[model samples]
Target: MVSKALIQEISQLEADFCSALSDPTRLLIIYSLADKPHNVTELTNELDIIQPTISRHLKTLRDRGLVYTVRNGSSITYHLGDKRLTQALDLLRAVMRDRLKHRASLAKETKATINA
Candidate 1:
């Protein structure tokens, strides 16, 4: 039920947009935005990152279309463009957890065989 063209399009979007998520700080920003919107100052203070770093991360997120902003008075609040992004991240985390457990089990088996 999947088409090659659709896959190509999705692949391009992933390359262009998801690249921003490759940074740990950006991932943290996404997770943090899931709870509530935050301005640059709040994010910098909460994440213990410098102001310039947070601003740079936010710029990347905005460029990637992963985040957006709302102007309020003299401040801007950054929001996740979609809630499903967090769900996708959670699914990836679960997959990673399973892979880790599988690797641990294999290591244990190997150790037992070596000791035998």
Candidate 2:
């Protein structure tokens, strides 16, 4: 029931989403914003990244629809727009943990073979 144009649009959006997450700084920004809203200054202090860098990454997340901002007087607080983002990050972390465990097992087996 999907038209070619719709499929193309979905593909483009997927690519954009992946591109948005391609940077480690952006991923960290997403993770930080997942818990609560924060302004650039707070994010900079918590992430230990420079203000400009935090702003740049936040802009990328905003563009990708992963975050939204609320203006309170002079401070603009950024919050996660979708909770699914945190779920996705959690799944990724689980996969990474599994991979690490597998690698450790392989390393142990290799060491045993070497010693044998």
Candidate 3:
């Protein structure tokens, strides 16, 4: 049986996971990692974010089990803890694209009505 404490723990973890993904910078970091693992310098260059900012987001992702890091001498490379995150992000992007298309269509129709 699931105890109250267990449920609360699960809820908190879920909240943490979602919270970790709530930032645009974090999402960009996840997307950048989707291609392959990268060290802080690489991520900072690709995302145009500062090294410290990337490190901060990486820490949050690591805490939430959303990313994994490997240390090689002085360089530490980060990768997605679960590759399925790319799939999730792709799905969300598809939804956003659909919504944007719908909004554009509505605007076009309104413009046509005004022009008529």
Which one is best on lDDT? 1
TM-score of each prediction: 0.88, 0.88, 0.84
lDDT of 1 at 28: 93
lDDT of 3: 0.90
| lDDT pick, better of 1 and 2 | 1
Worst 10 residues of 1 by lDDT: 13-22
lDDT, candidate 1, at 55: 94
Question: Candidate 2 on 1-116: residue-level lDDT in tens?
Answer: 99999999999989998899889998888888887888989999999999989998888889888899999889999999999888988998899999999999999999999999
Between prediction 1 and prediction 3, the one with superior TM-score is: 1
Cα lDDT of model 3 by residue, 1-116, tens digit: 99999999999978887898789999999988888899999999998989889899999999888998899899998988887888888898899999999999999999999999
Instruction: Indicate the TM-score of model 3.
Output: 0.84
Q: Of the candidates numbered 2 and 3, which has the greater TM-score value? A: 2
Ranking by TM-score: 2, 1, 3
Q: For candidate 1, give the lDDT.
A: 0.93
lDDT of 1 by residue, 1-116 (tens): 99999999999988888788789999999999999999988999999999999999999999878899999888899999999899989999999999999999999999999999
Q: What is the lDDT of residue 49 in candidate 1?
A: 98
lDDT of 1 at 86: 92
